[model samples]
Target: MLKPTIISLLMASQLVFSQKKPATTYKYGYNGMELIVKNNKETIIVSTFNSKKAIKDEIALKIYDMYTKKLFVNGDLLTISGNEAKVIGKVSIRKKGNLVLLDFYYDEIQWKTGLVEAYED
Candidate 1:
């Protein structure tokens, strides 16, 4: 009888805790994300005007490391460890006729992907 009550109480506690745990999320758009993740005892922001964009006529990739406070480019599936967090991802750009495609994949925390159908604007 006591064992059964203890088991039920433990299961209830587990359910309550699991239901109350907060979820991490990101605001995805052309303007980029302000705070991609703010959990796991660390914070990671975009820290840039634009993480993915097209300049002139070519696709330019710029990844900002909040930990190092440095900018990287043309990093295909690159990985880096920041002062606060670690980043591993890539942004691929392809041109199909008059339309351009941009695939953005950031990290395990969140992804900032975009599909733009613009030439060079």
Candidate 2:
């Protein structure tokens, strides 16, 4: 009985240590303001001026991250190709900060769907 108990404890510890944490991917868009996300696959309008222009001309974007709750990006802060990126889509929060502190890739796909389409596939 004692031997079996010891083995179970050791196995449990290994399992805990071996498991890896999940990552959070954020999607961002610009409407009147820049919006941040922690997931993907979303649609949004950027700014009132652009929103009134047309659908195809609107801004479409996605942000990928490991773990992030709040994203800080704006015309003065963050821009796409020198131009300002507006937020007009889905935004998700995170529990911890992994992508922010870690060496991860930030894929700014579909900044403007009319110009280019940013998809997972």
Candidate 3:
């Protein structure tokens, strides 16, 4: 009986250690552009880049489409500026007017995605 209990405890410990922790950042590469999202204080910070330059319209649209197909329910992409747009969903993605910030809103505890990048945030 003691041996069985010891085995069960070891197995339980292994399972606990094997589970992945929640991520606070994600990076995605699309058509040569890199999109990054990080949790900052209480807000999510998003940015995009192509080589060394910032990515605009087309790339941002593509990212929105990709995320929509993968994670969100049906939603509309609303243009906010020449460089950005927002996808309305359970978790909304909105572009900041300055062209450098993308605001993401969702309950982190309830949101999960496979696109989370493995790099440090």
Best by lDDT: 1
1-121: candidate 2 lDDT, tens digit per residue? 9999999999999999997544223444223433333335432322222222233132323233212323543222232331333333333322243322111122333333333323121
Question: What is the Cα-based lDDT of residue 89 in candidate 3?
Answer: 18
Runs in model 3 deviating more than 4 A are 25-121
Measured over all alpha carbons after superposition, the RMSD of each candidate to the real structure, in angstroms, is 14.2, 16.7, 13.0
For residues 3-118, what per-residue lDDT tens digits would candidate 3 score against the true structure?
Answer: 99999999999999998876544333222323454444333233343111232444455545556455443243432222322222122345454333343221121122332222
The residue pairs found clashing in candidate 1 are: none
* lDDT tens digits, residue span 56-76, model 1: 111212343322333433335
TM-score of 2: 0.26
- Each model's C-alpha lDDT? 0.39, 0.33, 0.38
Return the TM-score for each candidate structure. Answer: 0.28, 0.26, 0.23
Off by over 4 Å in 1: 16-22, 28-81, 88-104, 107-121
Distance from true location, Cα of 19 in model 3, Å: 0.7
